[model samples]
Target: MNDLLQHYEIAKKNANKYMRKGQLNAYVDALIEMNHYKKLMKAVIAN
Candidate 1:
């Protein structure tokens, strides 16, 4: 729970950082990771 939220925030920040740096690939990857955490969070809550 907390860990997932933390990782989600980290991934979001990393996505923003990569976007600002013009690293398209990295930003996309970070976004995917963020979404992954988001889904996991939702699943946890649902359970």
Candidate 2:
């Protein structure tokens, strides 16, 4: 969770240097995926 967030933040910061919107969007999607998985896991564990 933390790692993914950090990676996303770093990627966003450096995304302009690459001038690739798709690449930056990929990272954003990945960050959302990580959040989703984390929540899913938490629910499963609680059950």
Candidate 3:
């Protein structure tokens, strides 16, 4: 759980940095991918 949160934090920071650099598309894509991964993890954990 702690490791997953750490990875999410890192990914959030990277996405924000990309957005600040005007890489909106990349940032959005990264965010979407992150959310998808989180959802999948939740589903797996619920099993």
User: Model 3, residue 31: what's the lDDT?
Assistant: 97
Instruction: Indicate the worst ten consecutive residues by lDDT in candidate 1.
Output: 30-39
- Two-way TM-score contest, 1 vs 3, winner: 1
Pull out the clashing pairs in model 3: none
What digit string (tens of lDDT, one per residue) describes model 3 on residues 7-44?
Answer: 67777888989999999998998798679768766876
Q: Which candidate is the best by TM-score?
A: 1
The models' CA-based lDDT, in order, is: 0.99, 0.58, 0.79
TM-score of 3: 0.65
Clashing pairs in 2: none
| lDDT (C-alpha) at residue 46 in model 3 | 92
When 2 and 3 are scored with lDDT, the better candidate is 3
lDDT of 1 by residue, 1-47 (tens): 99999999999999999999999999999999999999999999999
Q: Return the number of clashes found in candidate 1.
A: 0
TM-score of model 1 (CA atoms): 0.98
lDDT over C-alpha atoms for residue 38 of model 3: 83
How well does candidate 2 match the true structure in TM-score terms? 0.51
lDDT tens per residue, model 2, 1-47: 56645655665455553445556666566566556656765666688
